[model samples]
Target: MIRSTFVRTALCALLAPTLSCNMLDVNDNEDVSGRGARVFDPYQSSDSGAIRLSLQQFNGCAILPSGSAVSKGTLNLPGYPDTCPDLLAADPTSARSAPTGTLRLMAGTRYFLNQLTLSDIVLNKHTNGADLTDAVRWMKNESRFRNLDWSDLGRVSDQWTFSTGIEGFSQDAWTREVLFDNARWRTVKDDTFTVEIIDQDGVTPRMTPVVYSRTDFLADSAYGGHTRVGWRMETVQAPQSPGDVVPHPLPVLSGQPASPPAYRTLVKIEMVGSTNPFKTFEAPFIPGPAILKVTWSQLPDEPFFFPIELVTPEGLAPTCANADGQPVACGFGVDPKFKFSTPANGQGYYEPGESFRLFLDMRDGDGNQMLPAGVLPSGKDMLADKANGLLYATQASYFTLLERDSLPAYMVAGPLQKLQVRSDPQAKAPYWSANAESVGLVDSLATLSAFPGVYGSTWTTRYSVNLPQDAEPGTYVALVKTQRYFLGERVAKTNSYFFQVGQQEPTTYPNAVGNCQLCHRGVLSLDNLRHGLGVDHVEACKTCHQRDSDLVPRIQTLIHQLHNSSPRYTQNKTDCTVCHLTKESALRPSMNVCQSCHPSVHGDEYFATQFSAKGEPNRFGNCAQTCHAQSTTNGHILPEN
Candidate 1:
């Protein structure tokens, strides 16, 4: 196979210099880039991740297809069904009532008690030849790898920042609170995620979890805001850990010729300063979750210095500049000082036929205040040199408000109704800047609006809006988007001001058993839902999801693809009852949503291929006429076990 791969590559290089070969990797059956691509030689790529049967291997024929045939197993998930039958029978009709009543809300952090995690993984690899030894399978927490304890290692934020330059965090431990999003706090106690390493030799080895913890793995401080920790790896020499901290047992990613999965986040950190930690290695670069993968032979080796890099969620890629062309400060946003003054977000309200006051005070890193429409700067100007072009310019800037269906805490926010834009500069109040000509919104709402100004060194603005009698009696969020020019680049920032209308009917978001913790082992990333939103309950998700989306699949289809590929589902598929609350009783009598996840039950080759290719299942729940076939076959009225 290796020789064959090379023959094709060699011929391509000689015959067409411009054409490169994408040789096939026999192990994973994936394409390996050649020459200009990753892997230059085919043999070198194949031998890197070669999964040969160990002469002392115990498990035989442990790969997909052969292993996938095993009966559907069950994980002891809390509040979820243990067996398929129990799940189908758990009725949620009584609890699935539409929110009838409501209550009032104030602005603040709505602490959500979310919990979830990855279930135990089931190893099912195929075995063709002999030489089977006790093969080891470890799902190392790629997110966490520690050396000495946290106290000894200190906090991640204590010394690390973007200014550390590239390779700043080469091989070090990151504090938990600073690294992991608040959503992931519950997943790790003392910044650790442990998965039992399974050695499935004979009859399924006892459940073993490979622990990923911080050097100072202990109870979170009662004072709050504790740090999560993990170590970085260098390839120069082996890794060395202090007496208290140690490395994880996960395998290392070798220089395989194949391109890793898109899910595998990799960054090539050019080593800076000294490679040896014992010498002087100030962990440069952004600190993130490391991918720890070691070879089968290197299990017992100490001072583990295998090359390491961080794994970031989709949008958190560490780049100097991002897709939007904006320069990246660290892995997130660029230079912009963020602060909110009066009428802070998640507060303020408007009732029908009633007027509400909207006051705003914001400032930029340059300490220039926000002026209303057409205001000029008074002090330090960062961008344009002209009167309006350089200073606090508001002629092109505006603030828009959306009539939301509900508050941001419980439902998909609006693209619903937009308030009228005030066209006049009749604003109330003073403003500040280097050039203070005149200021006000391009369009402003009625009543005591603030005129643009650059005086008193303040970015103050105000508005009074009177709601019509026919306005929807719901919630509204006013987003004040201000724009400025910094060094010839456009810089923008938005401030959210949430308010409710008359007779506010307050209700709690409905996220019972399907709490994220039940699935993610207690980590939920609410980045980029509805404009980077996160909701706690089902009712909130239904507002935008349960329906059609211009950019994403409907809730049903999205759920299928998300869970179907999740690590938890790979172990057991019957745990659907965990993240869902749709009662069987609530479902249409003639509808069976089971096909959403169990499309394989269709039995027909065409039906199987068609839907799987769609990357989702029958979300509308008309399996009866899917292909001139009934929802179920034979006498199986309910979903099969």
Candidate 2:
């Protein structure tokens, strides 16, 4: 009998295209509705007195005629286990009432529904009883309507109220607070009783009153104070479903991708001086100056590839100019003051993101060499600490030697000593010059080097060369060299700077106008239902739909006057959608799909609304009658001939 029933059902399905179910649940008792059938016990074995069907015959069922004979041996229904779990029937009574107050809804449900209803009520009241079809149309077009879920509504501040009791006898307490502790409710209007009920016990029940309130939906708060950018809500938790894991593993490699070869640029050089005559000279043999130390710190994050070549300028040899302005040329002696070039070469490559240092050695005119006092000789390399109170060094090789015998030695010294004395009665000499300027080293060097035939007085100057957009991405070493003139030759070659250049990503909408998405994307948290002059729609429209020169001043004055007028004024509206639409509608205004009621506020009208098109009307009659009727003479009256 069951096999015959299955055959009959299959024939009915094939002959009448109205039936949609692929499997029938014979064990279930639920009535089939229209052409739909309830599938029950779909896993029953064919040999257990059920339909013993062959795969080929079953597949050909749709092609067979209603009265055709079934080839019993060829008919087959594969024994594959069902992938879908059995679905339980929903309670009829439970379906009539709203789902549990605790049931969370998808975002934007409460806001969209509330706004739609409120807009309808406000429009009807202002339009002198105009039908609510337009308002309904707008709500249906809203983007959030389709995506809303139960959880979203549950999160609304005051989304609950009392309705009739389930059995029609008792009073049901349906406060939103009972459903959600955090929910808040604000009464929009006084409660009104809608219907009375009678219970199964034949007792009469009092009528229940209906009330309305708007919900405070949760929104992302991180961008609350940023008026120029828009923010969207994101889920804080990942999906807990077991099947959500990725099946494929991420690729792993041992090394980074090969980058293009790095280019080289020169960094600057620094020179330092050792002991002075006061610290090194004895009673008879006048001690010359000490050693000059030169060092340089490579750019912060550049790779060093080439040797730093220090090229000293021609003949103006390195010399010490004493207080009497006489030059003492200290040649290749243990601490000669004359300048010499040093080649900077090292084997190791500088890491792409690390900083390094380079150092140069030189002697003073009197052949006195300076001992490395800090990190250099000790190999501690503390050069990165700029505030460590160590000796100051510069790119240029410069220094001065003062007479240690001078105490005001000018008055007591002999003629030959005086000729070589180099004393400045008004000047305290080299060491004192260090204290004369705010920029300690630069100023001191400039001051001490004011003497004739002396070139060790000042440090080299540096200038920055800005990088262009098309410049290569890899690091380029920049070397700065400067020269100083002594009696005749360029004695010093100074070098400084190790740095990297970063490229900025190009903008996709470089010419985009005002931050329209700031409010349009629902990031501003304003009352979505409130119609206003500066709402997202109007703000976006103003981007391209600017008024003409002749009309701009007038429109501006009119708009400002309208919004600032008396609150009771009937015609005081300035919303921009009154005259715009996807296409013109006989009953209501549209801004095209772009300016449609929701989803996106941009569409075809965006291109058409440009100032060059001059498409928008100049006068405010239509807009005032629709959205700004409150500012009109009759306040809420529709236009009359």
Best by TM-score: 1
In terms of lDDT, the best-performing candidate is 1
Which lDDT tens digits does candidate 2 get at residues 401-432?
10011000001001110111011112221111
For candidate 1, the C-alpha RMSD (Å) to the true structure equals 29.5
Writing each residue's lDDT as its tens digit, candidate 1 over 1-641 gives: 11223344344334432211221111211122111111111111112111010000001111110011011122221222222111001121111221111101111111110101111111122121111121111112221121122122222221111100112212211111112122233233344323221111212222232333332121132111122221221111111322212222223334422211111011110101111111111111223212111111112221111112222233332223333545332211111222222222223233455644444433333223322231323322211122122223221111000001111111112211222111111221111111111113322211111322432222224445545565555434334434332211122333333334542332122222233323222111121111222222222232333322112223444455446533334434554444444333122211123443453444443332222211234223334445424333332232222
Question: Pairing residues by index, what is the TM-score of model 1?
Answer: 0.27
**Clashes per model (N, Cα, C within 3 A):** 96, 71
Candidate 2 has its poorest 10 consecutive residues by lDDT at: 401-410
Give the backbone clash total of model 1: 96
